[model samples]
Target: MTPRADPLTVDVVDLIGTVVVRFHEEYEHAAAEHSLTGAQARLLSLLAVEPLPMRRLAQRLKCEPSNVTGIVDRLESRGLVERRPDPDDRRVKLAAPTAEGARTAERLRASLDFAREPLGQLTVAERTLLKQLLQRMLGITPEPSQNPEQEEKKGGKGEKKREQGE
Candidate 1:
């Protein structure tokens, strides 16, 4: 049989799946080391970026708000998280990390120690594109940001075009 120019989607998906599974397993181990469940660890990681309302977090975590409440309650009991009224909307409570929680989160993030050096070679636009593509493949929405195409159009068209030409 003649070789195809592009790889089959199934093959690509299988490879991506393998990578995701491996990453998840490592994350779970790291979470366990910190005395947290994978779900709880994930919640902490999300909050580390910024405080978010329980409902919003549930939406991002793809779980019911009630589940987020329980998780938050547990974290609160451990002094890993705290609920504070949203300054803009007093009715809604945002989950913010405590100092200890932030420290734990930093430790957890540092422990991953995975192969990230290769990513250093990618240009900013290329890295953004890679991140967006992975998020798409994982069925996650890409966060709002200027895309690589937009970046190219803005000031790097010639540079990108030259790279593409090579």
Candidate 2:
């Protein structure tokens, strides 16, 4: 049987999935000693900032509120997070990290005990550039072309070459 050649284009969704999987693998490896699932550890980190409404957390995690309930239950079982009544609204439930959870976050961040170490190899300039590019790709900024003139200033040569199939 003859092999089919791969098309020149790559799907954006496939690229995103690949990156997510690679990041999760690295994160799991780094946090393996903590006896905490990656999702639990991530939730603990999120709660360390301030108590957040459970619904808001679920939105942030891009999961159903019920799914977050299970994630939070596991974290709560580990004493890494606590639930409290929202002061602003009695109907709302707030989630916050415990003191032990804060300590764990500090330990994890201070020990460089996560996938972030791979990013450390990049220089500050490279990191900044990567962040900017990713932000643009994610549509986080209204102005997608930070240097729009650069392409036009190339004097139409690029378009001509493309038209001629160079």
Candidate 3:
């Protein structure tokens, strides 16, 4: 058997786990209200920002390519998403959300206000501090503010771009 952890460490880990579980439950309820399974809802959300190829979707969802194909097939049947030939490679197919899909995904997001109720309890300063603390815990170093237009012009290399195969 493993040795017992410190009481403070155990409490912190338990709290984080509980918060994550609650958030997932809330998200599931929001998805169900739209008549979407969790996977389908997640796929729609992923495609909302930009079209992605099947392989890329699998990578993002941490699932097998075959699994993504099945999910895409179902979403396509619902007319929420469509498969298009990639511009860079005709052989590759990209999954893109249709107009209806985008609206549905937006609605699903709007319904999930789980964080709003609790986070609203904190003052602005407290919220800011909480965000900073969370970021630090995730090992993300805060960057100095930069001009949004400049960042856009630079193409934000740090952000993932959809590649032909990926």
Candidate 4:
């Protein structure tokens, strides 16, 4: 006889699986409407922030460099992204989004509202709590912001004095 599976474990797995599948489907549909494959859209989104070396992009995307090269090749063909030599290291190639790519990425974000509708149902406090819980679950430490307003609110006033043993 097979060992019985725990009901709670099964429920948790099902819930997570459902959410992942739904989100991916919604994103893929949005990408298709924009004439982009899901992988290409993701690559454009990643490059929008800043140019990155192919190796770094592969590491972040959790894929091989060869896979990234193929995606980049297609994007480049569309005049959405470009490959440039890294300033500090000429030997390394960096991928950067063109003006059109940035606009496309912005449009993609505006069109994909899958999470917004559901998350809007929660109260502000609930949303904050949920964000904290998710961050904790992912083992991420929230970083202090460089903005003066945020720094002041986070008790930056006494931080220096305390550090100096005042």
User: How do the residues 32-141 of candidate 4 rate in per-residue lDDT, one tens digit apiece?
Assistant: 99999999988899999899999999998899999999999999999999999999999999999999999999999888888877765554445456666677788987
What is every candidate's alpha-carbon RMSD to the true fold? 6.5, 10.3, 10.5, 8.8
Candidate 2 C-alpha lDDT tens digits along 1-166 = 9675455334655766887888777666545657777776677778887888888888887889898899888888888888999989988889988888888877765654334665555444444566678888887874454343443354433544444557
Inter-residue clash pairs, candidate 4: none
Task: Please give the TM-score that candidate 1 achieves against the real structure.
Answer: 0.72
Q: Choose 2 or 3, whichever is better by TM-score.
A: 3
CA lDDT of every candidate: 0.85, 0.71, 0.84, 0.83
Tens digit per residue, CA lDDT, model 1, 48-146: 999999989999999999999999999999999999999999998999999999998998998885434455456658877888888887799986766
User: For candidate 3, lDDT tens digit of each residue in 75-153?
Assistant: 8999999999999999999999999999999999889888877865554445556766788899987555433434434
Off by over 4 Å in 1: 1-7, 115-129, 135-166
Order the numbered candidates by TM-score, best leading.
4, 3, 1, 2
| Two-way TM-score contest, 3 vs 4, winner | 4
Q: By lDDT, highest first, what's the ranking?
A: 1, 3, 4, 2
As for candidate 1, its clashing pairs are: none
Which residue runs does candidate 2 get wrong by more than 4 Å? 1-19, 111-115, 142-166
C-alpha lDDT (0 to 100) for residue 82 of candidate 3: 97
TM-scores, all models, native as reference: 0.72, 0.66, 0.77, 0.79
The runs of at least 3 residues in candidate 4 whose Cα sits more than 4 Å from the true structure, single-residue gaps closed, are 1-9, 144-166
Q: If both were scored by TM-score, which would come out higher, candidate 2 or candidate 4?
A: 4
Cα lDDT for residue 94, candidate 3: 97
